[model samples]
Target: MMDGASQFATTMLLRPWWLLALLALALLSYLALRRVRGLGAWEQAFDPALLAAMERFGHVVPGAARRIFWPVAVAAIAILALSGPARRIADPDTFRNLDGIVLAIDLSRSIAEGGSLDDAQAAAQMILQLSAGRPVAMIVYAGEAYVASAFTLDALALSPVLAVLDGEIVPNAGSRSDRALDLAATLFSEAGILSGDVVLVTDGDHLTPQAFDAAAQLAAANIRVNGFLVEPTARHGDMPAPDRDGLERLTRLGDGSLGNAADPAPLADTIGKRAASALAKGETAALFFRDYGRYLLVLALFPALALFRRAT
Candidate 1:
């Protein structure tokens, strides 16, 4: 139910039609004054010589000036106060990114050797820093997949989860880029984001038929996959060599570029650009209204107070 005060406020008008009330009063007052003057009684009651003497000394009463100014001024103030005034407040939805980011890290036995996972982690941290607090999700996958954290803007909160990730976190053995990418895609789908990028941090040592199919699916879904191929200088001759050609193809198919872990600047720049574009597109076209009518009412008080002052 609407309160009495709210109902009354809405009914009031700054430019009220009842302002004609003042006009009617002024007309009536003018007619009455004219009739009184026509009767020649009020003027007769005052001596013509006394009125002329008063005018000569500049001590004439300012009744005519007061009538001409105060009523109109007070009415204008009251009318304006009745007109509602408002301020603008920014809407939260307008500033939020419509898309989301999913970081898919390859946490296989291969990344466990020669500090490859460490380098990937460092690169991932840089990517997060560059994001400027866009919503981000994390996926660590070997033969099996595990979600370290869901999409969120709070990097500090996600840090603890990211820190605890290791090759052993996924019980299964071997690198499965296909499973990781698919899971990242699933995360984006579940979150209801139609378009976003998935960053793959790996050595690119293996690529099953499933990986190629997953990349195609991701591309069709408008999900770009970026790759960071981390190949450390210290050679472990026993370990299998990374497939550079396969990594390049993965990036090409994913509609993104493959960057070397040693120089992540180019990849970071690209990711940063995409994030900026998303943010710009997310802003609301319309502004929100905030009521400032009460403050306007305070303004009416000044003119209202002037009503009591003698008109100049």
Candidate 2:
């Protein structure tokens, strides 16, 4: 909720250039006023002294000079209305519930070796099911990144694709979570999403500085990067352990949380809460000010009516 002063602070003119018409109107009004004072063509035909005598004697009615003011008033109001004054207002229908989510799944060889691919897939599925109709996107990354799905309201559209996502599907070898984050940011940019979430479902393998940097960038853009650590049920002695510390740091830098894949409901709920908070903060891509310029036209009606009545 904004105070009156705060709302006034945000007030702006959408068509500020139209305010220049006020200057033109001022010039035209000055010329019209001069013409009214001079009694039109009579001033050109007769001497100034004779015209003064006619006005003094009440022979040439100069009452029309007052009428000139009516038109000037109307034009001034119309110009103001055209300038398009607006102020920020909470519009629930348009701005609320506009936040989106992008799920970035890791398809690295380590996940297959650790045998946590099913857990990763299940975590992704639970998030999609709990997304509450928000437009969701997906990115699958190994050494490289690829968009599995663009933004869509239908969560079912992504289920089939998520079902087939495996470590071998991506031709690349190593895990590059940074590429996943970068690709998620690109998806948000293409879809004009200003604020959203990026949920990373991975075994937290091959974490690097670049991955943290990518998460920082997403945080800067008002997009949180959460992690769903898919711990392996059958751990291999040769395989690297899940980097919980690194994932925690990544989420911290990205201003999000780290949730275990064993229970994905909490992460899904967190995403929902963050989205609701964003809506409360008016941080959606559709956030816009309500233009009050049209209402100003209603004020012009008063002067317009005055001019009309005078003409009759």
Winning candidate number (lDDT): 2
The segments of candidate 2 whose C-alpha lies over 4 angstroms from its true place after superposition are 1-98, 276-312
User: How many residue pairs clash (N, CA or C atoms closer than 3 angstroms) in each of the candidate models, in the order given?
Assistant: 2, 0
> Per-residue lDDT tens digits of candidate 1, residues 1-312?
567665444342323464556666677667755554442454577788887687689875433434445455555545554453433344333333555678888787767665666778777877787765568898888887789888887755766766777767889988889988889988988887756788888888778888878888898887788899988545576766777789889989889788877677789677756742343233322223344556766776776776677645
> What local lDDT score does residue 35 receive in model 2, on the 0 to 100 scale?
79
Task: Give the poorly placed runs of model 1, Cα more than 4 Å off.
Answer: 1-97, 276-312
* Candidate 2: clashing residue pairs, number: 0
Candidate 2 least-lDDT 10 residues: 277-286
lDDT of 1 at 246: 94
Per-prediction TM-score to the true structure, in the order listed? 0.58, 0.62
Candidate lDDT (C-alpha), each: 0.70, 0.81
